[model samples]
Target: MSIAPNQCTVFVQVWVDVNALAQGSTRGCYAVSNRSQQSSGEGSANLHTNVITSSNVCWTVLPIDPQYTGDFSITNVGAESGWEQPPAPVAGMPNVFTGKLTQSTVGGSVNSNIQFSFDGDNQITVTLPVTITPVTQ
Candidate 1:
């Protein structure tokens, strides 16, 4: 049996309310990572040459095909964007944004601090655990 390093990871979060309109012990929550970016500023800039490195840059695990309609803040992120924070994520694995990917740690968890404001009595931020399975040829 050969299980080739087959499993790419991605992060997904959804948020929703859970009370007053009882739907069970759970509610729809959006996945959030503290590494989420703030887009109300500059685009990617090369500090070495002081030029804008424009490309599809995502700081954290954001839904590529976003289903919800709202605005998110992608904050001060630069060359060292995409990283989860101090005490890093071991070796070999870079904390940098790897394209359209949000890591779903097998033996750990990633915490994202997302801000939410709604016009309802129930409010909560949920970090959804998304699974990624790599396909083989």
Candidate 2:
């Protein structure tokens, strides 16, 4: 029996509550993804996916308060060997961030964190946990 390769694109949406931040609270910020099972912390989510070998992951930040203007960046916390570093924001999609995952021979289970930093008058950074399991083809 031949096992087919599993490949997919995961989209993670990041929501920022400007009013809450203005009021000195970071709890309003949160992130959710189509493949995520649960959410955690301020602007964090737990992603569980079977597309381990090659997957396209993207994150887009949406501010609750339109008046709020700022910039954000993705920082790698502890990604494994198969994980590819996040590249610069896409030209047309300024708010979108993306990365990729390659196949790893020295496998186990892949656990990683993708950290996002929002820069404005006050900088707020959060971590999103991602868990990926390799699929044999």
Candidate 3:
């Protein structure tokens, strides 16, 4: 089940909200794995090899809270691995961006909305619900 150009191959959404961390809010980690190679469990019996065209792949993140304003930095966690950061626009296969949220400080709970756009208008938004577990130190 190979995906043709302008075709939707796989759609994924995930929620992550870590309570505790080793290096406060300045240090943490997040990771995105490879998309499954199997096609839809139903329909076609043939297995689809996941291939990101790079040109068609993109990942974007935005804070759900309009008032919340802080440094929302992302880093490439997978270096030795083949996985890398998403390329800037004007570039093609869909790409995946994965990294931990880095900020000077974060208080209370917050939410982040992630969107993966493909085939122009076709897209998906993955929600990340963040909850900072209070620590007594």
Candidate 4:
């Protein structure tokens, strides 16, 4: 994740195909997002569901960041952990997940990878290339 070195927070948006995963033979889905702590010696991230569809399926989403501390879990509105899988197959629009990154302190260049797993067997991973550089005042 490449971001302004002087910032306090990092924002990330992820789009996923829940319908495709649900309609398939898979039984679950996992969505993930990652970000590094800013130069301020604080790091954290928040996640939320943006797009919506029918809630007929079940899923589990978790974060896998190395520098994560405390609580930073996100799930669908009616989901139990992280986000819920759609009840039925979706069409046209895609499911969206949003996240915020915070760190305990400036940890140099960070590489965060957000992953989405479906049906326990199918999985997809997305990486956030964050580049932090010193900014002039």
What are the Cα lDDT values of the candidates? 0.26, 0.57, 0.25, 0.28
Query: How does each model score on TM-score?
Result: 0.22, 0.60, 0.25, 0.23
lDDT of 1 by residue, 1-137 (tens): 11111221322233343341123333333334222342111111111111111212222323233454333222222222322221112123222222221222332222223332332234323322322221121
Instruction: Name the lDDT of candidate 1.
Output: 0.26
- The numbered model that scores best in TM-score is 2
Of the pair 3 and 4, which is ahead by lDDT?
4
Q: Taking the tens digit of each residue's C-alpha lDDT, what string does model 3 give over 1-137?
A: 22232332233222122221211221222322124432221111111223332212223232333543332322221122222222222123233343222221343211222332211122222222222111221
What is the number of residue pairs that collide in model 4?
29
Model 2 worst lDDT window (10 residues): 1-10
Query: What is the Cα-based TM-score of model 1?
Result: 0.22
Which ranking of candidates, highest lDDT first?
2, 4, 1, 3
Measured by TM-score, how close is model 3 to the native structure? Answer: 0.25
Separate clash counts for every candidate: 16, 0, 11, 29
Model 4, range 20-129, lDDT digits (tens) per residue? 34356222233322322222211222232221121112222333333333222222322112222212212221232332222213423222233333332344333322
1-137 per-residue lDDT for model 2 (tens digits): 11111222666666778677656565666666665443233244555555545666666767887887676666543354665643335545546656565665457655645566777677776666655555553
Q: Candidate 4: where is the Cα deviation over 4 Å?
A: 1-9, 18-108, 120-137
